[model samples]
Target chain A: MILTVTLNTALDITYRVRSLRPHTSHRVSEVTERPGGKGVNVARVLAALGHEVTVTGFTGGATGRVVQERLASVPGVVDALVPITCATRRTIAVVDDRSGDTTQLNEPGPTVTPAEWSAFQEAYEALLPTASAVALCGSLPPGVPVGAYAGLVRTARSAGIPVLLDTSGEPLRRGVAARPDLIKPNTDELAELTGSHDPVRATQDARRRGAGAVVASLGREGLLAATRDGRWRATPPAPVHGNPTGAGDSAVAGLLSGLIEHLPWPDRLTRATALSAATVAAPVAGEFDQGAYEELLGQVVVSGEASAA
Target chain B: MILTVTLNTALDITYRVRSLRPHTSHRVSEVTERPGGKGVNVARVLAALGHEVTVTGFTGGATGRVVQERLASVPGVVDALVPITCATRRTIAVVDDRSGDTTQLNEPGPTVTPAEWSAFQEAYEALLPTASAVALCGSLPPGVPVGAYAGLVRTARSAGIPVLLDTSGEPLRRGVAARPDLIKPNTDELAELTGSHDPVRATQDARRRGAGAVVASLGREGLLAATRDGRWRATPPAPVHGNPTGAGDSAVAGLLSGLIEHLPWPDRLTRATALSAATVAAPVAGEFDQGAYEELLGQVVVSGEASAA
Candidate 1:
């Protein structure tokens, strides 16, 4: 089973209006909600791909209850979430039907007391032993140590579990030093981490900072990998245009699932690239179009030339 | 004790953002939640004025639980809410800090099943015996009979309780035929009900259609009241400018409280006008500045001119 940790889980709400004009009242034509966060999104995609996934995170208050209740319906997903004192946050995306554009409003997640942090640490450690691979994803909510992911990485390594860390800012800077099995940084995150705009050079620099392997997502351009054994670049047949909200999480799911299945690096890269493109082509996050995924699976080109990174 | 019935209750959420640009993302800086609906807001204002207020409405699901929990904090306000199969609605007001303009998105309230409506009616009848006065306010949710308020008005009247009906559309038209003790209509609602945009003629037409008394809210111009005893027009000291969202609800609270206190027609009109203006001058809904209420109380002009109506 794959284990994913989301420190800051959210009740994702989407409001659809005819036109999202500033300073005007809207009769939201429709509203949709789902359990969300980077790791939760990753786990959902992994489960959809026929992997048994266990999700651990903080959930509290009414919104948190709703998230857990919704998660109960997804098959092969275990809820090992820890309860907190404060309610979970809600992220609203206002979709304008006129222009098909989305405006996001994100609430700052609940603050964790010191005692809650220790409890979460215990829970994470307890869940780590039964997992073949673990994923530490998303932002560090208030009251959590900035280096919290680094400690979790060490724990997973101690348990002999393959760990993948996906985060940005100071958390990423600190977690990279713990040497996770893999790190996926998008173009902006890579630039923010290594101060280099070029994906290939930044991935190399990120590896030098201490990552077993570095995979940088370059948006529509696809995934670039730099590892100690080799370097490769995987590209989709064409640029897929749709909501790219959870594309990176789907890519993470692809890589983690492939790792557990013991696929070669080239095959893993192909799956990751195709899954990312399929997610981008789908209507919502964490869900990929199976038709698109199957069609693009055979078409993704992975070239390993040492200079590909 | 004042009893206010909100058939369609809501969890009011306010989000603060730097600027609300369509098609762009926003990092909401602040979030605030409150129990709200027209009757709920009226009850809150009455409770703040030192009256014991009981709020009854439909509450179900997680959002409904949050609404009930929030009401527990307000002193002198009792929650006599009824449970339903569907969850109560949520109303979100996105406030743009840069422009100070709010974009409102209101969810259509839950559809009340037949059994739920019967249960709510039973609850309302049980609470009516102890109420000094009763207020039936706001829109009717889906699956409820449009003439539901008319039957409620009859129930309150049968119990010898003075009932005030505040709503719009077909419900308001049918409710007027029941001859509710009082009916409060704004300019637009009055126009739609009486087919006249002129407040004076529209108010007279509303009374002629069987309302015992009619109070017409003229926005900045204040209130115009036409009762069996006499007719009067109450105007504020000056044109108060601020959020007018809950001003009418405050006016309803003022009238309800004054009716229970045995105030004269002119005195009731003056208090209603002052409270309405005070609520408008305040920063948020359902709250009145005490100083503004006191200052406007003495200055409100209640001219008992026959030509006022």
Candidate 2:
């Protein structure tokens, strides 16, 4: 069973308006709501692809309840979030039709007290024995220590479960030190963390920081991965031209699924690109297009590393 | 007992930040969540001030469940909303500290299918006998006919209840024709409905259009009411400068509290002004300040019309 942790889950709301005039009233033509956050999105795609997954994090108040209820409704999803005092955050993506760009408004996640953090740690430890792989996604909420994910990674490693850490900033920095099996960082996140824009060099720097493997998701350019077997790059066919909100999470899902199934490096990259493209091509918010996934699987081209032996 | 109907109730979230930038990330310093909507706020303040209040309309889905759970926790409060398939809306209030002004991002309310509307009508009718006064508040959600509020007012009137309608646009236009006992339109809403910027003339026009009485909430200047006795202008103690987010709803709470207690028009205006000022002074997101209310009560001035006496 695959386990995902979303310390700061959100009830994501997207509103489509003709044009965005800040500080003014707007009559929204359409509105969409979904349970969202990096880990939640990853778990959803995996479940849709028929993977047994459990999502546990800190969810509280009404928003938290809604998130839990939504996870339950989705097939192959197990919700494991520990309750907290504060309500979970909500992230609003206001899409402007004229510009075709989304203006994001995010709420700072709820503060998880020391006791709540301890409770989550206990829950994760309890579930670690049965989990084949664990994916830690998103940022740390207030009152939670910066190295929270690092502690979880260490615990999962001690239990002999592969940990896939995908987060930015210091959380990634600290979590990498625990030597997680895999880390997925988008191009911007890779640059910010390693202070290097070159994906290949940044992946090497991240591996030196103690990550077993690094998969860098470069939005349109596609996925570049550095593993023990060799390095590989996969690109999708043309541009899918759709909302790229959960594309990276979908890539993470694909890579993790391939790892457990023991697929070759090139095949892993193909699935990763296919899933990422499928996420963007999906019409519904937070859903992946299965038809696109099947069509895209054949279209992704995987290239071997120029330097790898 | 005063009953307030918010067809599209919401979980009002206010995030306090230094400044708001479009397409850029913000770290909110303070966050607050409250059960909200025009009628919900009215009921909340009335309950806080020791008035019996019930909230009715359509509330369902997980968000709706949270609304009911939270309202149940508040003392002196009752709820009668019918269940619906869609989740209730969430209104985001972004407060910029530098300017101290609020930018509101409201979600379009949930769509109420014809079956859902029938359920709401049935539930509201059954509860009317228990309410001495009923208030129809906020805008109508999509799929609800324009004359929806008007029909609700007519139903309440037939049950011998004095209906107070607080809404805007077509809902307000159609609702007033049902001859609600009072319709409280803000200065802008009054102008929009009557096509007159002049408050006195606007109130007269609103009354002329079938509202038994017109009470226009004039920001900074307090409330202007045209009643059977005369036209009265209520002024707050000082310009209680704060986010005026829910001040109008607070005023409605005071007015309904006064009506239920059989207070004179002057006293009602005084209470309304005090409550509105208290809301500004409260500092808490959705609560009115009781201390401010007590202090402002003595400072409120009610001056009657020159022509009516």
Q: Using lDDT, give the best candidate's number.
A: 1
lDDT of 1 by residue, B153-191 (tens): 999999999999999989999999998999999999999
* Tens digits of per-residue lDDT for model 2, A255-298: 89998898887998999999999889887655789999999999
Candidate 2 Cα outliers beyond 4 Å, as residue runs: A80-86, A113-119, A191-198, A237-241, A281-287, A291-299, A305-309, B113-126, B143-145, B155-159, B191-198, B235-240, B285-302, B305-309
Could you give candidate 2's per-residue lDDT for residues B81-192 as a string of tens digits? 7888988887777778898767777778888999999888888888888898998999888788999999999999999999899999889998988899999999989999
DockQ of all models, two decimals each: 0.85, 0.50
The lDDT per prediction is 0.92, 0.87
**Candidate 1 chain B weakest ten by summed lDDT:** B300-309
TM-score of chain B of 1: 0.97
Backbone clash count for every predicted candidate, in the order shown: 0, 1
Most accurate candidate by DockQ? 1
TM-score versus the correct structure, for each prediction? 0.98, 0.88
Docking class of 2: medium
